[model samples]
Target: MGTIKRDKGLDNTLKVMKQGYLYITNQRKRLGSENIFETRALGGKKIIVISGKDAAELFYDNDKIERSGTLPKRVVNTLFGKGAIHTTTGKKHIDRKALFMSLMTEGNLKHLRELTRNHWYMNTQKMEQMDQINIYRESIVQLTKIGTKWAGVQAPEEKIEEIATDMDVMIDSFKGLGGKFKGYKASVDARKRVEDWLEDQIIQTRKGKIFPPEGTALYEFAHWEDYKGNPMDSRLCAIDLMNTFRPLIAINRFVSFGLLAMHEHPITREKIKSDDDYAYMFSQEVRRFYPFVPFLPAKAKTDIQFEGHPIEKDTMIALDIYGTMHREDVFENPDDFYPERFKDWDGSPFDLIPQGGGDYYTNHRCAGEWMTIIIMEETMKYFAERVTYDVPEQDLTVDLNSIPGYVKSGFIIENLREVV
Candidate 1:
């Protein structure tokens, strides 16, 4: 096997923290490797970064790559709680993932879509009464209520915003390492608060103090069993329960970006009002053009050769999710924010994976992906068709170097007027 150029650094953990989303893509460009490049990150471990269509295929291969011990401990305690679906693999993964897949049933997803639409409509009504509003924070409040209700988690309207605030703080901590000590501490505290609350709920349900309806996330997770038919620790079960509904609130970032897109492209904004199919394309474009997840790291399950070079077993590898979607070969004039590109696009899971590539039912792909698109499409539809507002002058720049990049101004809108 031939040797690929390796990054000249003893350890690249600091660089990865500094560069964030662009670290892998920048290295690939500098090394001039179209598909694969080598580097060391997260404390001098051998790591290879891969992009493009073929690389995506290999990255998601269950037999060739694994998820055990892939993510950093800080990310786990802060963003995704321990024992969440993002960590487990093999039969253990499949079994745990089934809990989420079950929640994604057509009936449940339809309910979620209806919930999204109703909440957006109400927010517009409220906005009409107010002088101005920040779409980012407002949508979080709206989605948190919707998500909690749909999951059968009994939380009051007043407490919903507080919970959303905690969840948002946890998600924002994963963006970059700047001021991470304070951010990390906040996130860890948030997780503990939420998890402790969820644990109490679990106990109440078991003791018959609270009896949530069957098939709801609260009820299912309270009774979910592992591969050995044993109940999960109450604390860990709370983590799994939190995973069921927290992702719905994450759609606030996409909603903020989608509104920004409409303001930037008036012609595209007007088109979605009349074309239902175009609205779907617009949502897809927002996911592609804007950044969400940057890269997903996995460990090589076996010794493998790619691009005439050897990748030893246990080597840390990452799939360049954001870079792959914007590759010139993958999408013509990829940098442009055109929704029409998806009109005739073939449905390949690997090409446009802001969420993750491969079969949603099987791989590490987000089970809530379909729900994300639905909620985004509904929110965009509401903004395009239901109301008219003005985008006030503000800093709308998107910082790509952040893990969960978003508009700097949170896409503020003022002078809300309803349209018949």
Candidate 2:
């Protein structure tokens, strides 16, 4: 029955923008509290910021909070798309989620891994003939090809660069104010272009003009039905298909970080090469250590009490994903990059929520999480065992203020060659 601690700010929007991933963690420390606090941002909207495993569990409890009407329109438009699975709740959410989870089966994951390996091999061969290669830029193209093909969408070879650029702009614009309008425009244009393409594919599939492999994402989603058994709207189906395509490309951020990790922690290079188990652990640590998603937003579904503080209905709640992963109580020496920590890890969903926490089938966790890990693991192995590149002197510093901060120089490298 204690009063919830509060920050003395009229609105924290600017502060949050300035502090970035450190915003919530810094607030908890400044207030001398471990978990819950209240602040205002987003035009005086009250936000309840919560961190740690217990808080994450409560934040994701569908009975307590829901995602519908929670995210800003800008986010919905630019990042998730209108009518996306991210905007649904209850039974509708479950149904839409199943459509996504269906694509993550062991067989499909193996297929994706094989596709990733082949694309990486081909890209490296091309890079071997170049003066320098940017891992981030190259990853976007390679993954766009892999993701679209694996998802059963066929982007013409001539259009891959244009499609990849649009996807990149949409992702980059969601986080900062500097280019938000541009991001929104890019999102609108990209959606129109991609949806038009996907709708045509769906029409072709229906008319038997194009044959997407059975069980592939495009085929399943294009033909998916709603909870009530009606077919999904064409635009929504397109959104869901991009959901698969975009996240796979977004793994480029992690690929950049993975290379940075290999550069900084040279021992990991050998460990990842020699042992598959170590590679898995290393991938987990990279996700836990690096900052990708800052927080997840939901709204209080009803009046609720958390840790004795009353939360009014419609209050915005942000589960601090970054802070939770860096909590000292949950992770010993939370700041260090240590892959060995996961060797005996108990695999708690809430504690390691880089994507999200809870059952993948029923909750708001990212559906493509397994695929992200696989891509990273495969990329890590390739960097460690297959490539011999020199990390030239460049700015490797990461800006915490950026929503998806990247290595400043994009982790420049030279003398690229296969480790024969």
The C-alpha RMSD of each candidate to the native structure, in angstroms, is 1.7, 1.4
On the 0 to 100 scale, the lDDT of residue 149 in model 1 is: 86
- Clash count, predicted structure 1: 0
Residue 336, model 1, lDDT: 95
Residues 268-339, candidate 1, lDDT per residue (tens digit)? 878998887988999999999998888888888999777777888998998999999989999899989999
Error of 2 at 105 (Å): 1.4
Candidate 2: what lDDT?
0.86
Each candidate's TM vs. the true structure? 0.96, 0.97
